[model samples]
Target: MAAFFKAVNAKIRSNPALSYLCSTHFWGPASNFGIPIAAVMDAQKSPELISGQMTFALTIYSATFMRYALAVTPKNYLLFLCHFINEGSQLTQGYRYLQWHHWGGREKAGVHGAVEEAKEKAAAVGDKIKEVASK
Candidate 1:
C-alpha cells in the first residue's frame, strides 16, 4: 500500500495536469488514503485505537522513517493519542517516553523535566523547550 501511494504521489508529481488536480479542494488522492487509514483503525472499537493495526503499523512505519527519536516520538504521540478522551496502548510508559530521543530536528535535546533525563543523565538541557514554549 505504501508502494502504491508512493507511486501515485510520484505520478501526480511528475504530471503537470495531475498536479493541478491534486491541488484542488477535495479531489486529491491524499483524501483517498486518509479516509481508509481512519477506517482501518475504527475509532468506535477502542479508545486507544488498539484494534486498528494500521495506526500502529503507521506509527512504527513513520517512526522508523525518522531518525533516532524519543520513546514519545511525534508519530506515536499524535497517532497513539485518543480522539476524544485519553487512550491506551500496548506500549509501556517507558517505551513511550524513550521515543522522545529526537536525533533529527534542530533541537539540542529531547524531553525536558521528564524521567528520561535521569535515564540519560542529562541535567543541563532539561528545559530546552520551556523557554520557547513559554514565549
Candidate 2:
C-alpha cells in the first residue's frame, strides 16, 4: 500500500491536477477526514450511486465540513452549501436532523440534481438553525 501510494504520488507530482491532489492528500489530513465527516452529516440530500446510505454519507460530510468550515467559508457554497450550515448547526443538531431522514436511491440520472437538492436542504436547515443560534 505504501509503495502503491508512492507510485501514485510520483505520478501525480509529474502532472498538474494530480500533483495538487497528492499535495492535498499529503498535507490535507484536516480536509481528508474533516470535510467529508462534516459535510455528510450536514448534507440534507444523498447521492444515489454512493456506497453507503444517505445517513452514512451525511455523517461523513458533517465532520469534514466542521473541520474546515472556517477555512472554507469563502467557498461555503461548494463545501457546505452556505454559512447557515456553519459548524454550530451541523455539529449541534446533526443527530436531530439526521434522525428521520432516509434518502434511498441508486441511479446515474439526476446525480447533479440530487446533490443540488441535498445542498439546498442542508442550506435551509443551516439557515433555520442559524436563526435560532443567534437568538
Candidate 3:
C-alpha cells in the first residue's frame, strides 16, 4: 500500500495541475465549499423556515473557521474563500431570521411590532389622563 501511494505520488508530482489536485490543500477547501453552497441554496427558502439560533451559530462557526484557515500553515486560501462565502451567507441568514422573528417581516407582526403596538396604546392612555386633568 505504501509503495502504491509512493508511485502515485511520484507520478502526480510531475504535473503541476495533478499535483495540486492530489494535495490536501486543494481537496480540503473543495469539500468545505459544499457548506456555503448549501447555505446559499437554503437562503432562497422562506425566512419562516430559518432558525435564528442555528443561523447565529453557523455565522460564528464560519467566522472562526475563516480565521483558522488563514492562520494554518501553508495558508489555505481556498479554505478561507470557502469560509468567507459561508460567512456571508450565514450573515444574510441571520438578517433574515431577525427580520422574520423581530422586525415583522412577511406581513406577520413580530416582536418589534408588538412592542410598538404596546407603546402606542400606553401613549394614548397617557394622553387621555392629561386631557382629563386639564379639563
Candidate 4:
C-alpha cells in the first residue's frame, strides 16, 4: 500500500494537472471538518455563521471529485484545466462564504463595509446594463 501511494505521489508530482487535483486533499478536510466544526463551536450565538449545510455539501463534492480526478490519464491533460477551474471555484466560493458569514472582527469592519458597498454598487451597475440591453 505504501509503495502504491509512493508511486501515485510521484506521478501526481510529475504532472501540473495532477498536482492541482491532489490539492483537493487539503480542501476536502477544510470543507468537511474545519469550517462547520469551528462555526458550531465559536459562532453558535452569531447569526452570521457559515452554513453547515453548504460546507457539508462542498465536502462531499471535493471528496467525490478527488477520486475521479486522480485517475485522469495524461492524454486528457487538456480537459484537466476545466476540472481544476471547477474545483478552484468551489474552494474560492467556500472561502468567500466563510469570510462573509463568519468574520466579525472590529479591525476589519471598515474593509467589510467597503466590500458591502462595492457589492451594492456592482448590483446597480448590473441593473443598468440589463436596462440598456432591454432597450
Query: Best-fitting candidate, measured by lDDT?
Result: 3
Model 4, residue 79: displacement in angstroms? 4.3
Q: Give me the candidate number with maximum TM-score.
A: 3
lDDT of 2 by residue, 15-114 (tens): 9767654554334443544544555454555432233344355555655654565565343333443323444444434443333334322333455578
- The stretch of ten residues in a row with the least summed lDDT in candidate 4 is 74-83
| Better candidate by lDDT, 1 or 3 | 3
TM-score of 2: 0.23
* Model 4, residue 51: C-alpha shift (Å): 6.2
* Model 3, span 27-51: residue lDDT tens: 9889888889999999999888998
Q: Model 4 misses residue 102 by how many Å? A: 1.2
Prediction 2 global C-alpha lDDT: 0.52
**Which lDDT values do the candidates have, in the order given?**
0.41, 0.52, 0.89, 0.57
Off-target runs (Cα >4 Å) in candidate 3 are 1-5, 106-135
Candidate 4 Cα errors over 4 Å, as ranges = 1-52, 72-75, 105-135
What is the model-wide C-alpha lDDT for candidate 3?
Answer: 0.89
